[model samples]
Target: MVAPTIQPSLPRVSPWALSSFWFGSAFHWLLLLLILMPADIERLVGSAHKGTYLGLLSGLGAVVALVLPPLVGSYSDRVGKRITFIRWGVAANVAGLLVMGFGLRAGFNVYLLGFLLVQFGNNFATAPYSALIPEYVAPAQRGRYSGVMGLLQLSGQLLGGVVGALVGTAVVPRELAFVLVAVVLGLSALVTILRVPEPPRQELPADTAPRLGWLQLFAQNAFFWVFVTRALFSLGQYSVQPFLQYYLHDVIGRFRLFGLNLGNAVTASSVMLLAIIVGGVASTLLAGQLSDRLGRKPVIFFAGSVMAAAAILLLFGPPFGGVLLLALVFGLGFGAFTSVDWALGSDAMPSRRSFGRDMGIWHVAFVAPQLAQTPQGRLLDWGNALQPNLGYTLVFGIAAAFFLLGVVLVQRVKNLK
Candidate 1:
């Protein structure tokens, strides 16, 4: 039998509480190590089949991401708050890191297992963690929260890159890196658990509301479509991302500027990443703040426009000797998109009824993009063989179209009001 329904006013979230959200995101860069380990694995194995091995590992990780979230999110929803999963998930995450450390120390073929576990830990905690935003945050303050999170993400990426570079670039002492990452992740998890209090669960009309079929529940919510749009856009956006180093090294630096020389290629790639970080910081912060003042739609629209422009620049800019400027522009656009996109996603959820479950759906959008990489790689190889920069140009042009389509889709989502 259904119980009586009660709905309380949403709670006010403190800035300190919001800061913890960013703190958690900062720890996320550790997950990148999982993706990166394959290169080291290739060197260790002394095989020419690194691509196949990398694909298998990544594929397994993607499968884990797809499967784990719904189970974890549904469990969190049933419990009426996310803390249960959040606390334990962190413990499990640390344990996974320890396992990874031991695996590396033992010289076991454990990269695939460790990567899958990392994905599981990340998603298990991630969905439940994000659900807190819609429950506690005032819709009006989401912009500030989004901005801070963006800064945290960028800082985390920079820190991760610096750490990777500093680890001597040789074997990387895998066990040590794993241990340090575990410690850092644990510290961040502790901050979130102790500092941020969960919002009380809402009580909706239980008696009259019919049990919902998944499709029916989804059909009533326009937010799901927005999530779809977000996913498709992300897939299109990243179609060009993996090739950034390639573009800088082979096309811009080696072929065009340095006459296909290998020496200048590495330095150019490094400079491009630096440019990206700088531009990304500037645009993300600016977009987040602007969204706070002007409303999300306007900021989202502007971000889309910037992204489209950047995509076009990437396509043609290499030939004109403007690749660095294009790289910076692309970074700016991506920063703007990511900075506000999270809060925008939170705002569009159907309700706090199952914030974790909803957020799991949102995350699927973020993760699904990786599955497209294989096809994109094939396209790149084909295009590169035909003409220099041709593959990149086509890839980025498609990304631009996706951004433009996202702008149109954003207009259709009147759910925020």
Candidate 2:
């Protein structure tokens, strides 16, 4: 009983290898969610009904994102070919992005199908892809990896914001922007496919084979807590996200700088998002490293609390400048949370052999909030009808509550730092 053998570690990840794929992922998604989708829906259905239609689209598409990942991940676990799944997913996603772009004038049904396809493809790739993290990095180094992930993720958001402001104002490209989205997204995945090799499956030395049902395999207490915590966080974020453009227009009024028209909602929203991203970028890497030294729980708790406070402040209908400052505050908290988000689930994974499947179950948390989009949208409509911007107040109030609860519940997650 003298000394334990040290396992050889995976090579350190290059920053490019770690970040490029995620940056592309964030870029396309933000382009769609924040700018394109809203503008398109408004154009098709008009501003009066934009919120409801957007909610309908998001909620419907969310079904695919919610269901596909867990099942696909389990299949990937069995097949041991995560890269193949990723390739297929990318192909489908790119095709869907093209359909959405080119089919802009083709009515809502075509747009809906395109979005559904994108959702399916994105969730399909991400589930199996997420397992790569725990496989490639040592536990101690994960915070650094997450930090890098957050930084690149925010950077992509900044680019998406720029593109959206430029092209998304009219629901696109005209088609070049949409094509650009498909291109950039596909190219990013290609980078990872070419440069980052998938790690070989890690199997337990002394395996005990036992028959367990699908839910039983992944339904541990820690998993349950983590799922609830994550779902709550996503709930908070999405509550405001789908409505930000509208908020900038309705509540703050369209912005202008130096006696120049900033082109209504898109430009103002982009400016707000830029501020947010700046704050998030500044804090992301630092937070990730901090979590490594200080424990994930403390960092996440503090960040969530900050976000909750910011959301609460949004209820007042602050002026444009004040809103940008609040966005900055919110972004700082957002960066810290996202920095460690993957590692959060990775740490609490119940089955090493079934990492893909378990992680996919956790991925459901991200999509669960999408289910609320429609209901919340309807609520916004109703509240606004009752008394102007009352809907926003309710939506933000609930979001703040969700944020606080999500952060607090993490304290209950056993066996996680």
Candidate 3:
């Protein structure tokens, strides 16, 4: 056989080279703290009732998630500089964090104020920041970039969990966690300010692209269904997440030979999260590669199956005794699904003219679940009335259903070559 000379790999932007990663990493760590805060705040307030507070917090976030992206993206495109919006957005997010931190320190009616500021700032920054990914990355390299992004996100979440565990173990005070969150976010903002190169202003063709009203654009896209399906997937996935630790502590602990320990609960949740991070990074990379090679629908089908399987396992049992190996099963499937989901979502964006606006609409699906938490909580309460495990099982089942629905909808997406 004749030998074929191999070409050297092309040099592109290093996935970790940009300031955005630093900013994004810190943003993720602080976000995880926010995730852990409801329970912490409930304990701080000397009230056993954390459900209503959490429900309201998540619901308001969902509302903001739905509204912010299109507004930010459209404006950014019109203003002709994405970074200008991103810079201001990060500043706003920092301001929001300061308010939240001060509220925590001052013993004000901080829950509502904290939640609202955090949600607004977080979404304002996130919507524009995410839109940049497609703008900067070449279509061919997107999967690798997405994988790197997912890996960083997961690592940041794990880092946050470690901090939470230390706090729970008396290694750090709970109040200090909020300070840590603020500092991390401030650092993330600084990184964005320093690192990401702002792209030049967009020049639209005189006649090819008209400045359409938001509602007009929303009404025109067939991909809108895909966006809604994505939102459903988000709703199902997150609806069960906030309560996972509670489940491990309350339900799984019953099967323990040793008594339930809070530290053990955090450890188990940390383990599950670690599994998710690992699986998610691997699967995301694989999905992106496969989507590029085998096409998007096949990868979507494979990923949907993995997601549904994970949901079923979590529904049936979680952190099952070391013997059953439940965590591994859930982690593998969940991770693969996430990888494909990012790949598919990125694949579905339209032309550059509508990219910012459409992407903002798509992201609404990602954040829409915050609103659903209120209804989910009500459903959970109703389920508790019937049986202890019924609510969680139902939630997991719905998550699986949404995953499947997302698969079905992806089949309808066109121009995804």
Among these predictions, the greatest TM-score belongs to 2
lDDT of 2 by residue, 313-386 (tens): 97788767788899999999999999988778777776556777878888899887898999999999889989
Q: Model 1, residue 2: displacement in angstroms?
A: 5.0
- Give TM per candidate: 0.81, 0.93, 0.84
Off by over 4 Å in 3: 1-14, 17-35, 44-48, 101-108, 205-222, 254-264, 322-325, 340-343
Can you list the residue pairs that collide in candidate 3?
23-188, 284-339
* Residue 16 error, candidate 2, Å: 3.5
lDDT value, candidate 2, whole model? 0.83
lDDT ranking from best candidate downward: 2, 1, 3
> For residue 280, what is the lDDT in candidate 1?
74
Model 1, stretches more than 4 Å misplaced?
1-12, 19-27, 30-35, 41-56, 97-109, 169-175, 201-212, 253-271, 315-322, 382-394
lDDT of 1 at 408: 81
Clash pairs (backbone) in predicted model 2: none
RMSD of each: 4.3, 3.8, 7.0
Superior candidate under TM-score, 2 versus 3: 2
- Candidate 1 vs 2: which has more lDDT: 2
- 341 in model 1: Cα distance from truth in Å? 1.5
